[model samples]
Target: MTSAPARTERSRTDGPAEPHRRRRMALALAAGGLVLGVGAIVTLAVWNDSEFATGTFGAGSFDLQGSTDGAAFTSDAAAPGKTLTFTLDADTLAPDDVVYAPFAVQLSDTSTNEAAVTIENVIGGTIGDDLTYSLFIEDDFGATCSAATPPAGAEVVADRAADATGTVDVFDLTAAGEPVSLCFVVTAGAIGQGEAGTITWEFAGTSGDTLP
Candidate 1:
């Protein structure tokens, strides 16, 4: 009896099909990993580049000008009545800046009665010798005044008061001109330097007159 035809050996091609399936699976896993890595990089870049905060900065600047009319303690033997004019200027300055201004004058008396001679006597020539007169800008805030030299014939005194005033002795007066200046000094609470401000002084009296 013819035994059942031996079954044909299963085709050996099935072995090759198993390896192909494994390769496809591995390719799919690698693609998925690559996609995940790209997504993570994109997220980090966006977080770092974003503008999370904001801020602002600003700045500003100032100047001072001053003038006086007469010097030399008003000439001796001058008219009884004379007036002196003074002017001050505050240049453009920052709001934070502060300024202080002070001034002084020199005078003298040739007459023996120093008590009888008044500012007028010095100005009028009633007292011929040189004398000094001074005015101070009250220090509303504690501050200092700047020092300056007088004209060629004038002399500047070295006396300074804590109250923002300066003084010159009668002997310091010159026949030439008065020493004048605008002082810019820093005080507590001042913001910065170069702030502009001005100070002025005016004198009016008879040349030979005296003040009470």
Candidate 2:
């Protein structure tokens, strides 16, 4: 009888063991591939660079003030500003009568910028219609508004009807607080004996490095 195919001892021993060894080798190779992918990703993350920047800042100040006596400076920013301390009978009225007052202007000591100042408006009440007025600048804080004629070398800023509007002159003040002395001369114009009222003058100042 034909004998069944021989099973060699080598075949029996190698068949199953060979398949198991191959599976273990394939698992080791797959783990090695995963480790290589993780290493490459980490290398990309480590190779990096960057940059940045920043800043700082601040501001300045401006102010204006007035003095009626040319000694004590203050702000009279609105209508009916500091009352003009006129010489002679300011309250009394006769034709051709005249009176004088002293005033001064300057930038405040702490002001950080220079200015251009103006006599922006003049308004009169009941007595305003019956008066004429003039503004003059003098060298000293003491006034010459009462002089029979404007003082020698005096500068006239305004000579107009008592009831007038708009700026008559523009003057300058340095940031270091230089002073400008002013004089007001008011004359009666046949006003009635019983007439009495108020007058207001407004000064406007603009802060700047150059005049505006």
What TM-score goes with each of the models?
A: 0.26, 0.81
Worst 10 residues of 2 by lDDT: 149-158
Top model by lDDT, which number? 2
List model 2 lDDT by residue over 1-212, tens digit each.
99999885775767799789999999999999999989888843466677877666555555677788788888767677788788777888787888887788888777777777777545445777888777777787764656554443255554577776667655778655677888877878878877777667777767778322
Clashes of each: 20, 0
TM-score of 1: 0.26
| Angstrom error at residue 97, model 1 | 48
Model 1: per-residue Cα lDDT over 112-204, one tens digit each: 111211121122221111122233332221123432322222222222221233322222222223233322232222224543322222222
The C-alpha local distance difference test score for the whole of candidate 1 amounts to 0.32
